[model samples]
Target: MRLHAASLYYFDAVRRAGSIRAAARRLNVASSAVNRQILKLEDEIGAVLFERVPGGVRLTAAGEALARHVVVVLQDFERARGEIEGLKGARIGHVDIVTIEGLTRTFLPEALGQLHDRAPRITVSATTQGSDRIAAMVTGGQADMGIGFDIQRQPDLRQAAVARFRLGLVAAPGHPLAGRPWVTLNDCIGHRLILPDASLSIHRILRPLLADLPPGEGAFVTSSSVQLMYRMTLAGLGISFQTRLGLEPELARGELVHVPLMRQGEPMWSELGIYVRAGRSLAPSVDLTLRLMADHLVAVAREG
Candidate 1:
């Protein structure tokens, strides 16, 4: 059955808001107009798309199936428009990215600076989120790409590139363990530790290592913010366990030192991945940003 763009857009809004009136408010249109388009779509498809409830409507199996196609169709249309603009010698387009909080402080800013130098017309909209939410943003079409550590495999997302970053102990220059090439969890437990909380991916990577330490010798301070953790480390409050990816500035300025977290005298590593929605073609601006980020991440990984 043929469907209009208006119908698909109205349907998508209803699915997201779960209430026709709510969707209408968001779309700045009348509720009856939104309902009429959805009804037309259902008639063309010959099936009830939503299960009307007292508070809101829920997508039926048919609606769920159609929603997936609608996302792809709308995204493809946007990509096509961007490509057409590129063909007309205009490099103007927007690239949206969702990344881990750490990158915003270090790698992302550098990468975006380079991107702007290369393509001044391209605009970037970036959001910092936890690693777990990065993949979901890409899959949902909210962001063109996601960058994070320890991202699990998702059916609707693909890993475009990856870097394995070594987890390490970071401290101020005068700290006792700062001179060490590597340190074990037991050795780290002897001092105050400023550690990432369960919300951060680094926390999960260090969980096994922490489990190996004496039961009561956990982190002295646990936080989800990378910047706060880094600041605490620089202030000589405690050593933090983290990757070198976002610590380049501090390391270069002699503000912080990174010693590899050792297990049997070898460094522990976590995988950092660049992700995009599976089976979707990227727009020109997104493709360029992905390449730039991949290059920077691979270089950082190699150095780590």
Candidate 2:
């Protein structure tokens, strides 16, 4: 069965927006036009793609199946266009990435900036998501790449590169724990603690460590935002625990101190990984970005 590009475009937009009117607004087309395209697609496929919900639409089983193929088809089309541009001596394309929130503060921006400086014609779009969602996006072909900690393992996703970082206590420069070589959970519980919320993989890793702490010894505040946790720590409200991946600026400026978390004098560590869909060939721009990211992660890992 063949579907027109416009029909597939409208179908994908409606799937994303959940409503024809909203998708029309996004596409800058009339709602009736979008609806006609969707109807035409359903007629060609001979399946009801969406179920009408009260305020929006939900995908049917057939819709779900088609959506997956649609994502791959659209991505392949974009890649082919990029290759054609390359053949014409123009190196231009877009790379879509989904990453964990922690990288936004420093790692991702720096890497993207470096890529832009070297390849001015290439553009990038990045969204911050939790590790699980990042993995799903990469596996489903919704994103070209994912960067996060402990990405969910899936048959269709491959870990392109990884770096291991020891989790550490972060505090303002003059905080009481600043000079410590390493600290145990028991030592940290005595002070106010800013903790990562369950959305972050770090929260899962640290859960067992905090589980044995005394009843009243718990987090002063919990949040999913790494930036918020860093700011609170800088304000001396509490100490926070995280990898050193995004802490370079603060550590370099002496704005914060990071002491490794320890158990029996051994540091606690977590793996940060880059993921891409398996059995797929990446576009040149996407491949370049991935290489740069892998190089950057390797540098950060060696800094430990």
Tens digits of per-residue lDDT for model 1, 1-304 = 2244698999988986889999999999999999999999999999999999999999999998998888788777767777888899877688889998888877899889889988899999899988877877788776889999998897989999998878888999999999987888888767998988877888888887778777678888998888888888889999998888778888999999999887886778888899999999888878888899899888777776
**Residues forming the 10-long window of minimal summed lDDT in candidate 2:** 1-10
The C-alpha stretches of model 2 lying farther than 4 A from their native spots are: 1-4
Model 2 scores what on Cα lDDT? 0.88
Highest-scoring model, TM-score: 2
Question: What residue runs in model 1 are displaced by over 4 Å at the alpha carbon?
Answer: 1-4, 10-64, 302-304
Q: Compared to the true structure, candidate 2 yields what TM-score?
A: 0.93
Tens digits of lDDT, candidate 2, 1-304: 2334689999988987889999999999999999999999999999999999999898999999999898878777777777878899876899989998889888898888889887889999898987758887887666899999977688999999998999999999888888988888888868999999888999988999899989899899999888899889988899999987788888999999999999877889989999988877778778888999999889878977
